[model samples]
Target: MIRSIIHDEMFLSVPSEKAGKEHLQTVQDLRDTLHSVRERCAGMAANMIGVNKNIIAVTMPFGEMVMINPVIIRKAEPYETEEGCLSLKGQRKTTRYRKITVRWQNENMEVMKADFSGFTAQVIQHEIDHCAGIVI
Candidate 1:
């Protein structure tokens, strides 16, 4: 049986120095129980990616990042956008990279990299920032 994750817990704290550690743990926990966790984190099934939910519903699992230690390789123009988190009850304004390329260690501890743009870029940056212990 798959179960959803508790979304509210993620938004409960400010991303302190331990945000990266905490986010990593959260991702791991999700991966460990992904079936239910994904369902719970995802508010919409097969919906286009947007700022509707705090969780990023990746359309493709291939190269799906579980950022354990994510670092931005490049950054583009700053843009303000409407965003929402499962942890946060309503939508809020946030700034994110218009473009970003990042590298992170996977669960296997292998170095992996990706480049993202538009909404996908935003989601990755947002989640990675959570891992880095930063909040908007």
Candidate 2:
């Protein structure tokens, strides 16, 4: 189910709750929504689709991935960059890490941890920020 992109700053500002196995459908929906907007967006959070759950979908060079309750365990090499969102107008300047290690759950609810770098890492960081209710 492709959901609508939420633009309400107040709603987007509120932090999302942790996702569980029961939230699997939300994960699918987030992926669907992300794919729907792939031409203009590279990633999306559950909150961006109006569901306040700690879920995010990102498009990588290989494929698309969904992260539930993602946490950034480590970050290295910070740099400034500007980003745009389907839920927000224009791009905003923010600091991002060139490399990041994250722990998150897959669609099956299994824990997965891995390191990401460059654009992929940046996209993950941005989506994680959405989960934390920080709209950059």
Q: Count the backbone clashes (under 3 Å) in each candidate.
A: 4, 0
TM-score of each: 0.61, 0.97
Model 2 lDDT at residue 129: 94
User: lDDT of each prediction vs. the true structure?
Assistant: 0.49, 0.92
RMSD of each: 7.2, 0.8
Give me candidate 1's TM-score against the actual structure.
0.61
lDDT of 1: 0.49
What's the true lDDT of residue 16 in model 2?
Answer: 97
lDDT of 2 by residue, 1-136 (tens): 9898999999999999989999989988988888888888999999999999999999976667999999999999999999988889999999999999999999888899999999999999999999999998
Stretches off by above 4 angstroms in model 1 are 1-28, 32-64
Q: What C-alpha lDDT, on a 0 to 100 scale, does residue 5 get in candidate 2? A: 90
